[model samples]
Target: MTSNAVSIKQIMTTEVLTVHPGDTMEQVHLVFRSSDIHHLPVVDEEGRVVGIISKSDYYSISNAFPLFRPDLRAAANDRLFKSLLVEDVMTRQVATLTPEDSISIAAGYFKENLFHAIPIVDKGGMLVGILTTFDLLNYFFNQEVFLPT
Candidate 1:
């Protein structure tokens, strides 16, 4: 298939790791570490993308109110901020793409929204897979055949 003909479903990472709204920040951090992914689609009981969380989001909340002066040593012991919930720190307004969408379209959305990763949803709006800039990069760079005119 031509590069343009390749769809997101072909390259999207199907193993989706999600978090519930009530999950604590500390719990989410463990998920992040275990999954080895920075973004997690926050889902409701029905598996809809209610929100999204990123490492940057957690760091932003954790560092927003520093207990002490902004010192490297002081910041190392920031475990006190882990009490925050995913709902408190996650971006509720999330941008999502469908699995059938073309890779080019997904790339454009990522570029326009400045998003590193976006959650993929099915027709019912259920979380399916995740597409990242890295995935797209790998698709283009790893392919030996370039699209023909």
Candidate 2:
């Protein structure tokens, strides 16, 4: 089959690292550092995705307020940053994909959007997996066993 025929479920990662709206910024910071991922899906108590957090969002907050350093002007912002929650910074308007969607569809989303990752959810809007550009690249370059002639 051609790449266009390949479904996202075949390439998407079922084991996803997710966060909640109530998670603290510090907790998200540590998760970002530890997961080594660029994006995370924020879910609600019922497991429905409500938002998304990207590494750039964290950088934007830091650059806008400079929370890491103990400089003169940043003191007030630093305190505020520490007290801030993930929901405050995460993008509430998130783009998502379904498991059955084709990889071509996901590629189109990536081409149209500035983000590199897309959250894969079921009909109930519950997070099931994640798909990233890296996953696409792996399919193109490394999944030689399944690539069609």
Q: Tell me, what's the RMSD of every candidate? A: 3.7, 3.3
Clashes of each: 0, 0
lDDT by residue for model 2 over 3-42, one digit each (tens)?
Answer: 7889999999998888888887767777877887888889
Residue-by-residue lDDT tens digits, candidate 1, 1-149: 56569899999999988888988877886786687788999999999999999888866765665665668524553464466777887899998889999998998898899989999999999999999998999888777664453
Candidate 1 lDDT score at position 105 = 91
Worst lDDT run of 10 residues, candidate 2, spans: 65-74
Clashes of 2: 0
lDDT of each: 0.84, 0.85
Please list the residue runs of candidate 1 whose C-alpha ends up more than 4 Å from where it truly belongs after superposition: 64-82, 145-149
lDDT score at residue 96, model 1, on the 0-100 scale: 89
